[model samples]
Target: MRKILVLSVSAGAGHVRAAQALVAAATGLHDVEVVHCDVLDFVPAAFRKLYAELYLDLVGRHPHLWAYLYDKADRAPREAWFSRMRRAVERLNTRALHEEVARQGADAIVCTHFLPAELLARRIAHGEAVPPVWVQVTDYDVHRLWVQPGMRGYLVAGDETAFRLRELLPDTPRIAVTGIPVLPPFAQRHDRAACAAELGIDPQRTTVLVMTGGAGIGSGAAMVERLLAIDGDFQIVALAGRNEALLAAYHRLAAAQPQRLWPLGFTTTVERVMACADIAVTKPGGLSISECLAVGLPMVLIAPIPGQEERNASHLLEQGAALLALDATALEYRIRRLLADPALRAGLRQRCLAIRRPAAARQALDQVLDADAAR
Candidate 1:
């Protein structure tokens, strides 16, 4: 059996989720041994905490500032002074990752996040004979941070993203325009009425699923309130991902309007919940977007975190798969519009299905294994 190491960083849940999806596909092959890990798991506690949580802190507390920082970081050349310093610091904190890579001795390595890819690429450049590494871009956009040396291949969300990757890493051996890999469940079908009944919701009513991001990062309570204000026979499912406080807030809202507001906490089975809804109102995180697309669910994106997410919104909009809601007024207007127009809803759904590649995980795994076999 050929062993495949799937690595990610927990800077955001998307990267780790993408890695898990790949592992899910790889596990079906009896001849492949898949090892999944978060690079942060092997680092010192403080560094891990800072590396993992800092992005959330910045995006949540100061999004505009985060956008500025995101653009600033993207502008720096990989070989520049600060870029070298950041890489040096990452190396210092992840001494054990080098050891871990040496120990794995796998036929192939896959990284859904850029951090480990950076380290692994450096090792290959230094003549460490690291296994062939493939880096998958988790978003529709590719930031400069994802440009790493010595990678064997690049997997990206679309042809546009693949073009971006090519511009950044011109000498890469291969670039595959694979959609972001999502869990198998997203690609599977579910009974809408049965799912709604299971969630204690009225199956006949129009349903709107509002995704408070996996990390509880979205336009939060205010957005929920705006959706509620729309005059329609509709209900909302609010997903408050690991945020206990948000869950509490959701529960309180449900208490006052139990029939209309349904609160959902963090869950591994989001696909089932998604089946219960007619449309999704989300922040347009890459994984969330991919899941919606896979399910052929229409989307109304609200308050995308600037940079990659902003680009993701633009991509969906250009593809005619989703609508962008900037604030409470736009949010209310869009939901109301979707509810009123079946033709519009059908059009959006068709567009979503048109862009979805539900078998991305399996396809990506097959390609990697085929390449490994060739070598």
Candidate 2:
């Protein structure tokens, strides 16, 4: 059996979720032992906590600053001072990671986030006999942080992203345009009426599913309030992931509204909820967008994080699968408009259908394993 180590970080839920999806896919293949590790776990506990807290603060409280930093980094060269500093900091955790990989005898290393990719690339550069390294880009845009010359394989969200990556790494080989891997549930078909009945939602009413990614870090409560104010015969299902306060608030709101509002905490049944909904109001994280598209759900994107999420929003808008709402008023307007017009909803659904790749995880797994075989 071949041991495969999948490295991810929990700075945001997307990277970890992507790693989980890949693990699920890999488990079904023969002769593969998948080991999952969070790179942050190797760092000091204080640093890990601070890293997560800082990410949340930047995205939730100071998005504009995050955007500025993102743009600055994007424009900077790979060997820039900031890049070097970031890599130097990352090196602190490398010894622990190297020990873990050596202990597992990992024959292949897959990275869903850039930090591990960089560390592994550095290992290969230093003449270490590191196994084949496969880096999966977890966002619609490829930042300079993810580019490394010696990576064995690159898995991207789509051809447009692939084109951009090729431009960034002209001589890099094995770039595959695989969509971001989502859980198998997202790919499977669900009965809308059955799901609605199961969730106790009115089958006849138009359903709007709202998500703000796994951290639940956006203006979810405010968005829900705006959505409720919109004049339409619709039901709202708000998923507040890991945000206990937000979940409690929504639960209280749901109590007052009864059947009209359905509040959920972090759930494994998001696919079922998506099946029951006609539209989704969400933040455009790559995994969320990919799952929504897999289910052919049109989207009203609100307040995506400055860098990758912004790029994801642009791509979905360009594909005609989603509409961006800059504020509460715009979100209300977009929701109302889509609910009132079946033609518009159908058009957006068709666009989503055009781009959906339900088997992305499986596809990515096959390619990664095949690359290992060839090596």
Tell me, by TM-score, which candidate is best: 1
After superposition, the stretches of candidate 2 with alpha carbons farther than 4 Å from their true spots are 213-219
Off by over 4 Å in 1: 213-219
| Model 1 agreement with the true structure over 1-375: per-residue lDDT tens digits | 899899999887899889999988875588898888889989999999888788888887788899998998899777788889988999999998878877988898999998999998888889988899998889998998888888888888999988877777767578888789998889999998888887899888888998864222334776687677777788999998888888888888789876899998888889988888889988889999999999999999878898999999999999999998887677788889999998999999999999998889888888898888988
**Candidate 1, backbone clash total:** 0
TM-score per model over all chains:
0.96, 0.95
**Per-candidate alpha-carbon RMSD to the true structure:** 1.8, 1.9
What are the per-residue Cα lDDT tens digits for candidate 2 across 1-375?
887889999998899999898888876668887778998888888778877889889887788898998899889987899888888877874678788878778888889998888888888889988888888998887888788868888999989888888898867779998899998889899988999888888888999998863223335676687678777678998888788988988888888788789988887888998999999988899888998999999999887788999899999999999999877777778888898999999999999999998888888887887888887
